[model samples]
Target: MTKRKNNNKLELIVAFSWVLEKVCDSEFSLLLPLSFFIIEFVIAIFLFFQFSKEEEEGVEVAAEEVSEEYTFQHTLAGKLWTENSFNSTAFKSTILNAWKLKNPVEIQDLSKNLFLFKFSMKRDLEYILRSGPWSFYRALLVLERVTGEEQPSDLTMHFDTFWVRIYELPLMLLSEVIAKKLGNIFGSYEEMDLKDAHRIGTFLRIKVTIDLRNPLKRGTVVKFKEKNRRDHFKYERLPTFCFIYGRIRHQLKDCEAFEDLNEEGFEDIEEQELSYGQWLRASPLPKVIEDQKKRDSSSGTCSKNIFNVSSGQSRCKTKEK
Candidate 1:
């Protein structure tokens, strides 16, 4: 009876210990899920705050960009208003103000390259202003001021003169000639010395200096002789000033092949002033007879004697009269 009672007490103690362990494990499992929820919620809040901050920064940047564009437009408008005054003082003041407002960083960075670009822009703006009643001059002037260059003087007069001459020309011919000349100017060529006349002839189909500033008036013709006994005459209708004034010569005042054309008629009566009209009227002589005729005309009495002796030799006549 004593051994049975001892075994039953040991079994009761083991069963109570197992129930306590199961209760502790269940409580730990519930707490672990709650801690994980708290950690996830904190991380979500942190990410949301970060995203909001980035969006605010983006909005601020966009606003700044818009403000800059508005400021530039405003400056351009102000310059236009100032240009309407037509007073030098007002123009200078406007330019100075614009310069003061320009960004120092840009000025510092582009100073060197800006020099030529600013000059070209200023020149172009001045031309546009002088051209018509358009109000875009003010905007162009403001741009020039910011870039740092002075507008050309008498720009309006030059533009007017250029257009007047260009309009006088036949539109089709003018476009064609200008296009051809520009191509010639920019085209590649073999290296040549400016002083060497022979080298120039080797490359250029037609060598002439054209002045772009002043075009030729209507009814003008330039003529040249080719080796094949043909005359080449180029008629000008409202040609550019360069066509009229530009002279091609081996030396100063020394025109090639036709240097005599530049001389006065005091030396030879037959050698008259070579005008466009005279060149048009002149006719070419046969190459074989040209030299002989010139020699006979120059020798006068001597040529007559030579002709008489040649005639006598062919007839075998003894003249005793």
Candidate 2:
């Protein structure tokens, strides 16, 4: 409605301009009184000011409407970690297939591999954010939840949350305190499985925000009772990372260090000679646990068994018939 009004005002201005131009250019204009030209010019000036004022107001209203429409509370600013260009159509299709989002998601390509994913529901947004860092064609999708007044391009894309499994920690030091400390060595610790301390598992699972710009942390050395031991690190759902430099931003082939090695007459360097390897990727969770998660998500209920720390066993809760 406001746009139509503005269009009408613009048309009126154009019409007045055309009329003034014709009157001044025509031979009959010399026969008109001086007051006639002055009055016509005054009316045109008044209409021009009125149109300008209304157009400015209309713009403000339009901006407000857009702001109200897209709150960006359930939006994520994402950028693909790749130097090559990407096809937005293929990227959108891949996202739909990969996410299988229950709620509709609006994808806006911001050029330069940047995108905005606006989800209809907050739950969908949260699920996507938590399940990341997602990838497209082997390139890591760096995502950050939209917050405050930052534009899509201004949002930080360096840090991404990943489930890092701490391996080879002594049984005695597997508590939450130790988990937080160890998790921080990679990045800011977000969460950890509290029950992991009680059970003797392959590794203690903890979520942390890793800096993609930095080299991937392989492991950290710990000292206990004047004895030092090495603890390995593994990332769950890890995407393509540069084996040559241990960075998550790009693959080994695209790495500058790899090119430099070739330029230095070391093109024959084997994969084994790289600083990183497949060992950094953590194995998938057990099938039973994964099925339980699917069931819980489908039913919208968390009815999984509680682990009894004292007995060092999982205690299932049977429902009454």
Candidate 3:
């Protein structure tokens, strides 16, 4: 009996030893994974804070640069736009004769184009910009403003006028009707320009100005109302005006290819084009267009090439076809 009791005690001790070893192994497995996750979490937190600090530092530097540039920028600025050739002596003389000048310092010819003028006083700068669209020879100044660039440059980058074409409408519709229809779709257009449908069965086309954004997609519909009935007119964007001429600064009408298009073809801004057929027709490149051509030639602003059917043929179409 004493020996049997001793064997039972020995078996119980071996069982307890196996259970202890298993618990220790299980604990180690959980602890090793938890340790790795905690390390990664700490590393991510450190990187986030570091990136935030760098961004704050960059903003501070930019702010400092802007602050330093603001004061001298406005006082040193001037802008001018006119049809006449730019001359520093002539500009200074004109300014002095026209307005009050405070400390009229000797001016600098910032650009050959008269884009910026140096002035000593803020009042002089303000006064000069406001002094009427000063004229020279029959040309008027179109732009005058205060700008802050050290180099002579245009205040804004864009053309004052752009052209668009309106789709299918009545044959020889009155200009007033065209104006009302155009005003309904586009806001603040300059004039109602109509083109004779040189193409078959098409009598006239109306074009609308769509500026500073993506043009309306193809087949966009415009609805007009007449006596409780609706007329839907569809319109689309014309190809870029410069693409046909292969140059910039001039649109299709202003191009030499369009030398045939006279001021008569365009509706007057003050008075819309009121006549039909004979009115829509131009009298063989009117004197006004010829005079403009002479002026452009004098200013060294000739269209580099002629691409109309009237030149008997077009250099551009020949190359493309």
Roughly what TM-score does model 3 have, to 2 decimal places? 0.28
Candidate 1 residue lDDT tens string, 1-321: 336444654564466446545655775755555655654565455444443333556633444354332222111111221212344444444443333322221211122111111222333334322222212222222122221123433122211111111112222333334424422332322122222222222211222223323322222222224322222333211111111133211111222434444355223423233322222211222243334544434533211111111111111112224
Candidate 2 local lDDT, 1-321, one digit each (tens)? 458556765776677667667777888677446635665676567555554444556633344555566677888888887777888899888877767655688998877899988889887787677666677876788888776468655765888888777888777777778889988898798888765435436678888988888999999998988989898998876788888888887777777778776655445767677789888877666555555545545534323221111111122222335
Q: Candidate 1 vs candidate 3: which has greater lDDT?
A: 3
lDDT, model 3, position 137: 31
TM-score of 1: 0.16
Candidate 2: what lDDT?
Answer: 0.72
Error in Å for residue 190 of model 2: 0.4
How high is each candidate's TM-score?
Answer: 0.16, 0.68, 0.28
Q: Candidate 1 clash total? A: 7
- Candidate that would win on TM-score: 2
For the record, the alpha-carbon RMSD of candidate 1 to the native fold, in angstroms, is 34.5
> Deviation in angstroms for 211 in model 1?
17
Error of 1 at 232 (Å): 20
Off by over 4 Å in 1: 1-65, 68-172, 176-321
